[model samples]
Target: MYIPPSSTSPSAQTTTIMSLKTALISYFTFFVVFVDLTLASKHHVINFRSPTLYPESLTWDPSADHFIVGSHRHRTLVSVSSAAAVDTLISDLSLPPNTTIVGVSLDHHRRRLLAVVHSTPPLPIFNALAAYDLRSPHRRRLFLAPLHDPTTDRPIANDVAFDFSGDAYVTNSVGNFIWKVTPDGEPSIFSRSPAFTSHPVDQSLPHSFCGLNGVVYSRKRLPPRRPIKHRQNVQSQRR
Candidate 1:
């Protein structure tokens, strides 16, 4: 089951871990936690009650008034409605056989859904960025941005970010780099330096050998901050 915040409140977006064994309904301003289980029923201001397999990430789509979920076991995306209806938003990306869809984000300005595709098997693991058209449900315009790290054996694409220009930036957890995707869906190396190297000095620390996880870009002039998970950051920039 998946729980998406019913409202846009800051408190609603609080980070939570949904236990796969328990079932409960929570209302957050910006976030919702989905535990592993079968949905009982849908109630007021809440829906998306059902069984889901390997749900990895979710993002709220204000235009469609629904939450988009990515499957870690399947390379697909689905939308859950407040009325307890589930719909297939994207699937059959025609990627490699073992690709899994992990992170998802909405590019409101571009009217597109950006996703990270992690491919397993076929040695020297690589990741790709997928873009889907949001103009209509019937048209499945797919664009791919493939990435790899010549220095590392395994590179995992985790999350995505958009700069002020609407260009997409993706986070590589294991490779310690940020990839930039053009509006046309072309991908290129945006930034990769030794500064992103993870030391893993203390096991007790939340730090992981995977350098970076989540990132955010701002239109304001403020400094940009990237969240280093054990994994995320928001910054303001001038438009």
Candidate 2:
């Protein structure tokens, strides 16, 4: 049966068809990753999902002031800045073909970058924590030092963060757990279990959990200091 096209013009129909194809391709390519960039007018843009490749995670480097795009299939990290002609490839790793980057963060003074790679096969749901030392100009690699227990195979990474003290934090979407990665490559728990979670599955029930997605190190305000009055009355020796 010959069905009419959505539009009368042939070009319109062709355009529609092309759009659908692109959408499907994007979905398949970027279903495992999500990114955000706000430097340009095209802010809040999802790079890989727009006729691009398997886009993993997106982040901003204050030093470079550029957007970083990481992918699993490509196993590469690309950076795009307003000054550059196009995205520049930074790191290439031997990670899984279906890996997805969940978070990216940076520390300015220390000249460091942290990334969390979640490896999922046939599905984007595996718990793996990968990081990189972005200070080097020649050495580009994704060093994945597993944080999860070797015994308990869990799901994917949802978020990552770094503190001013060089401490790292990660969120597991499926395991309902959070881990803190030390500067010395040690993994430990940052918060209590169920740290970050999704909404309740029950449609009738109403609840909200802060969906832990991008864990970035930010400047948290310190508590105010107490006022101290030192009254050293010039001891005028009125002897």
Candidate 3:
């Protein structure tokens, strides 16, 4: 149960939780690798060595024509398509040391990227949200949703995503609830499904935090503005 700390958006004027540890061993008694399979041709299948995935969210950018996958511990997104892995797009994110990610998005628009990172505080221990800069790649910039208080220094962010209208939503594992954070500087409850709370407290791994998958946005549909109050100046006049 480790969370990392994130820097406040220069404009959003908000605090974010982060994590500490960087190794996957913090959540499991034993180290385990993940495996996935897909059939490309009618009679052909292929297997590849993918990271032990912790699905955050996914999206596709028709402009880039790739599917992005976010997981724990890494700062790159798995660029996927109907073909195969083109390349791993790195993100600019300052994550908790030894942090592993589980979420990601694929959009031609927007600047802030989401992923599930795990780490432990005081000694690199955590399990929280890992933010990245889309403009930049593979650079750990800052935590957007810190879990522990800089004073108390004890909090964590589980997972994060944005709704259809660009409302950022996150799973506050510590609070045992999902939060709907409006770009308008407002936060609300999005989901409280028992599945989120039922998760075991021990080095037990998450068994499907819902879609816990990826998000996709077509480049042709890039909103006139970046992402509403999300990527622009925090001072926004609500309609």
Candidate 4:
């Protein structure tokens, strides 16, 4: 057996190693290409044009085949179709000047659209919510309400969610609280967690921001399994 140890040449071993390297490179390239194509097929783009409107939040209307966007600049709710048709659903609310709209949600059962409105100027005020009646004949009925918190000074209405019973819940990013609004527009603090509190300004950067930002609700449904209470959670987007 020792006499036949040198039967294979060095060039033959080098060629075999080169073949394996090439095969590995080919497999890696194919995997990357497959993943890229899979992701690309799942998403697409839609475009619209509104010169004065700076959109911050969007919600889709499945019944009408259009999307509603909240304007931060014009302070309006504009509708954009899939074919790029743009129209103003509600021109303006009774809010103050420099009001910016953020999160929006549709209440199908209540036939209303709720939007989070905040003011930007010398002093920013983010404690307002606006509701529009979707079933109105004129299509412009507007209602504005303020969310108040005596414990925390800064209350920014960031996002909104609804439950099975048509009650609305909103997240206050700066105040670290959740507000509940009834169908009649009455607002009260739902929950306040100390976890959303931010550090002192003097101890950190002057522009540091923190608190609860987004909220969502999930309802339990089962035929014979007795009706359970709806569960909700607040998600903070801190900086």
TM-score to true structure, per model: 0.66, 0.58, 0.45, 0.68
Locate the minimum summed-lDDT window of 10 residues in model 4: 230-239
Mind giving the per-residue lDDT tens digits that candidate 1 earns over 92-147? 65777657888888888778888898876563475888888889766465678787
| lDDT (C-alpha, whole model) for all candidates | 0.75, 0.62, 0.51, 0.78
Q: Which stretches of candidate 1 lie over 4 Å from their true place?
A: 1-52, 121-124, 193-195, 198-200, 203-207, 223-239
Model 4 quality (TM-score): 0.68
Task: Report how far off residue 183 is in candidate 1 (Å).
Answer: 0.9
Q: Taking the tens digit of each residue's C-alpha lDDT, what string does model 2 give over 23-131? A: 9999976754443323334645433332344666767777777877666555566776756434645544466565666666665666666777776656644555555
Tell me how far the alpha carbon of residue 193 in candidate 3 is from the true structure, in angstroms, after superposition: 8.3
Estimate the overall C-alpha local distance difference test score of candidate 1: 0.75
- TM-score winner between 1 and 3, please give it: 1
Native-vs-model 3 lDDT?
0.51
Ranking by lDDT: 4, 1, 2, 3
Leading candidate by lDDT: 4
Residue range 129-174, candidate 3, lDDT tens digits: 4455666655344445443323224334555666566666665545
Q: By the lDDT metric, which is better: model 1 or model 2?
A: 1
Best by TM-score: 4
Candidate 3 weakest ten by summed lDDT:
32-41
